[model samples]
Target: MTPAPAGRDPDARASLPLLLDAVLGVGSEPELQATLQHIVDSATELCAARYGALGVVDPERVRLTGLYTAGMTEAERAALPELPDGRTGLPGALISDPRPLMPQDLSKDSRAAGLPPGHPLMRSYLGVPIRVHTEVFGHLHLAGKEGGGPFTDQDLALLRVLASQAGTAIGNARLYETARRRERWIEGAAAVTTTLLAGRPAADALMCVAERARLLADAAAGVVLQPTPEGGMEIVAASTHGDPGDLVGTTIAPGSAVLGQLLGGEPVFIEDSATDPRMTTPVRERFGPSMMLPLQSGGRLIGTLALPRPRGGRPYDAVDRLLASQFASQAALALVLADAQHDREQLAVYEDRDRIARDLHDLVVQRLFATEMMLESTKKRAAAAPAGDTVGEDTVGEDLARAVDELDSTIQEVRTAIFALQQPPSDAPTTFRGRVLRETGGAAVLLGFQPSVQFTGAVDTLLPEPVAGDLLAALRAALAAAHRRSEVTSIEVAVDATPARVRLTVTDDGRTTSGTRGTTRTWESAL
Candidate 1:
């Protein structure tokens, strides 16, 4: 070590290298939390103090929002009932003044707020405000000099320099974190858009958005709520750590204070959902800080995207609110585009189906009917021939008659295929004919061939919803029974509507216990 001149302080010279090392170490950490803790530890070591803490001030500077401590063992920390909020006593004074503080004997200092139970005793104290570009970031406090003496002017000076370096490090760390957070959100939004545009159902799209937002926001749960017919919002999709079944279907009634804001496409930020009077849902008690952002694009309000944390969780900052709101807007636009694409696809399918149906009715059915008529004519001619004119004239007439019947059945099958092609492909069938086809179509998967379906009278107009439902249930049961039977080759279903009643008849060609070739079941219901 170089010798100090007669008038210079040798202690300052001795601590110079340690101060430089502390400054280099603090700024090197990229993470904000790690940087803060490192600064506290370095400051405590440089000042030869027994305890040190760094309390970060909130944006408003009215209270301490975060605390990092060093020199406290895990057992010592666990023994304390709670950490201080730094809103009172010497810590508060430093935040307010933004100046260095040193007190000889904290027990005698009037500004001292006595420690909580199980806290270590302290006498000397030193505090300094860390500033970043003229704005106070936090305060660093050191207590109990190592040699049982009060903190000196040299220690205060050294602590102040270290605090200045910590400010710069904290700023760098915050910027890095903010940039990383933004990138994650952007990537998440892009992923959601890709999934939606790739063609997902409406329910699946909503759930995708919820899951992505929950992950990006680090929330305990994410949910999407849409307006119901009763002028309220209902949760249709939810993504959570646990089972989300209970959260789905939860509603915000029309008169809720928060409902108005959500419906109007306004964002609502709550510090604590459990205690907020505006939150009326029964599930609110499970969450703490919450953000309800309207998923809207252009002039249409789609729904609300809610991200909520569990109780006692960290509240969201300004950056979080901004990023999340932007994400919601993007997700809404994607949903609209996906819905439009789905409609276009459906229309295309309908056009193709109509063309095929037209071909069957115009060409295929016409040909089959013409063949049946020619066969009938031949059978008649065969019958009219003299008894000795041909070797097998009776056999010829019978063969011609059977050919005509087969042609007639072929024509009916073509017409049924045309009808099946004409119905909408994706939605649940509402009309009687459509529903019957749906039942028969489903059975085909298990039966290995489609059942022949025939409808007599205006079934759709005559049958009530109740009757139709019962008929569908009966048809399902018949199909199931047919599937269970051995040697089943075919199934025939018919629905007849009369002025006073409707009937469903299901017949299957399967060997019965008595070795019968067929079985028939009929269900009748009054109008």
Candidate 2:
């Protein structure tokens, strides 16, 4: 290749071939770090600077992220002070302002005041804002021009053009990084869900989710909240190795602290928990950055997930929030599913018990009724027999009558046993009116007296489940009360069903010493 012409147009000199080569050179970057390094190197060479630094801006564009750098030894770079977060220095100001800044002497600039302990080699500097459209992505600073002079307008323009290219590359790299992170999070969430759904109990599943969240987010601690019976949150599980035994079992009231905010279905972010106004307890003193995200299932708030970092750690950003929130959502769903499974199991047990009760009632009650009829027939025969065929025959008749009495007592014992067996289980079905009535009968027997229940109209067929359940419960209560009184002789239960409603009446004929001796309690419920 022949020597290039001297004093060529600077724009033309740095354009086309050089830019295309630089862009194409980064195509082989297999990872995000490699891609970022390639871009920084390209930026340095394109601007012809002795030193170059590229800092990725945070989501709010108020902080610099240490990702990649070029043209400095490890020790030299380590010796340099940390870069300012916001639009503090000339470089950050340019990035924030999204404009080219060509400072003749950066060391003397007013904005360069209060430099931290040991800053890198910098003098005449040209800073360009790396931006994609209107959004500023980061800052690119070219320090100490090798030719020894202040950066000219042409240099500023050239840097801006090169910055544009860097912006595109940086944007692509960031996008790639974001997508990879998202993929990893998605896979992690799926794994956690599988682990949770594999019959893990609620506490264990919550702990797994916390561990996975801490690992994925690289957080110092992770906590999971579950709603308690009192509408508060209990920290059921947590990963707090950095400060173990600190946050576990902590009860946070609903809407009281950061955790409460999350449980109330709002995400809470505290850049510094130690100083945040929302932090109400002394426990926050150990943590700096923290995020609380709600865990919900079927639109119902299950609890919260609180992820916190150490006091000196960097603040959490949008990416952290997104990842943590997604994890919380998965954990919420798992918790809800586990709870539902438990409920279903309990219901099944109740159903089984109810079935057994029904079987006993059907088999035992029929036998007792038959026995009662036999006793009635025997009593009739004993009365109908002649006064006395003989004195010895009278003795025989007395023995027969005693035998019938014994049989009657045995029938009463069987009835009592059947009543004891018919008690309703805790989770018994609330729908079936017949089932309810049978349970009411058992309850009545315990109080005393076998209530004579008569269904006047199709009571069971007309009433809805809720109404029927309530009516039956009320009737059972009324009958129990009547049997409790010593004066009550007989209980008569009547259920009347109409098109619009069902009415239940429980009456007892008991002798009141001073008044008309009858007590009636009636309940009417809509279908």
Candidate 3:
């Protein structure tokens, strides 16, 4: 027998305007979720079911994307651990088959065994597939008709109508959400480029990308990793809503399965970071649902951009993956261009410094030398006529000597300044090793011999700033003291920054004014 029209039955006619309003009123909802909730409520009321739910399957089509339910209290929803994802058994039949289904007495259905432990015992079911265009998006499952009777054909008919309209509303909502996400990511990319090209330092440029990406992706932490010279990856920059120390400087050792792919400019997705075999870093234990996207431009891999959410966080969907990857590519290109700009700016600075050095040597030093020569000549003449002259020849000689000493000191200072200007701005001593080497190299000229320098352990990476400053100052003092001693022919400098302490030893084979032998000075500081 055929089902009667909902409009013909007196009771169904009363609900006709409501059902039609639920369909036509969909356009009134500016937010897709509100419209969907309204549809679910209308379906439950029309069919006289205790519960109604719309399950949206993920694009992978393997599981439920999300579940929106009606007729359940907040307490009931909260007691559940997480939403179901196609493990609903018989009701899932509609999901797989994309057809209308109405079943009573679920215990008899073997497939109902997959139902969750705490799910309310549901009986007398009605379900219909929600489709978008030709594709099945998900299914709507309604259960437990009120008034104690089996659901008639009329209830199934009304549910189908709502399911049909639900498909259209859900599709529009998804499109709007995707567009918003794309807008955010694109804006993030533009922001990154703008901030990087504004002449910030290299480290700051990387951080800008991290901060913006973390906000856009709503991740717990955003980290930027670069391939190390030691055939590994190092976290060079990170942005976090909490403490960043743990996230920064984390390393992925060589021979890592994940690093290999990342270095090759491929993206890696992790469902659960704490358990994923490919994630070997210690930080992985704190996060889940991670995306590691390579930042590459012009066939050169700059680094990997990783955004990981806290444990049990929502998984990244297809749109998230795509937009984040695109952002990474754009960020990489901006980084490359920013670095080039920095190099060009440095070149200009170097050229200006070189010109200044030339001017100092050609004009200032030459003039100072000429004055010294004139002063020396006057001193010599004064000394030659000293014995017979009544004029204060002693005073004249002392004045000329003092003038020559001052001029020599001035020239030495000017020469030192010019030497300083010669070193490239980029090569300035920023690390402990570089600073130590610079000090020794600068002293070599005064000693007329290069100092033999040796290092033990990671001096550059392990040495702290305060100790490094103290050590460098002492080294300069020792070198200057050595220059004053007579017969200084050789010098040696050693810096051993061990795990527990930093030790510095300097030895010079130079005799003091007293006929003493070589001298050795040692300094130590706890790390």
Best by TM-score: 1
Worst-scoring 10-residue span by lDDT in model 2: 424-433
Q: Give the TM-scores of the predictions, in the order they appear.
A: 0.73, 0.63, 0.69
What overall lDDT, based on C-alpha atoms, would model 1 receive against the true structure? 0.87
Tens digits of per-residue lDDT, candidate 3, 1-527, equal 87776658866666788788777765566576787777778788778889888777765746786788988889888877766778468646666677787766665767666766567777677888878888887777788789756677778777788788877887788788788889889988998999998878889999998989999999989999998999999999999987899878899999988988988889999988999999999989999999999999999999999999999888898889999999999999999999998888688767857766786778667768777777777767776874778576766767677776667555554654544443345545578888778777777766678888999999988788999988976786677667767888888999988789999999998897579979999999999
Q: What is the C-alpha local distance difference test score of each model?
A: 0.87, 0.71, 0.81
Worst 10 residues of 1 by lDDT: 415-424
lDDT-based ranking, best first? 1, 3, 2
For candidate 1, lDDT tens digit of each residue in 296-338? 9888999999999999888898899999999999999999998
Runs of candidate 2 with Cα error greater than 4 angstroms are: 1-19, 59-61, 152-158, 227-232, 241-243, 253-260, 356-527
Q: List the RMSD of every prediction in angstroms.
A: 13.3, 14.7, 15.3
Per the 3 Å backbone cut-off, how many clashing residue pairs does candidate 3 have? 0
Mind giving the per-residue lDDT tens digits that candidate 2 earns over 1-527? Answer: 76667877756665656666766765556466786688778767766777777777775737775646778888876886665555567755765576777778877788666556666657888777777666877777778787877767766776676677766766677678888888888888888878876667767888888888877877788888777888777777889675557688787665665655665699988888888887775577888888888888788986777888889697777877887788788878877776776677667767765754674477556655666676676667666668765765665567666656655544544444444355643334444556656656676656565777777767656877778757755664565455445577688878888888778888888754465688888889766
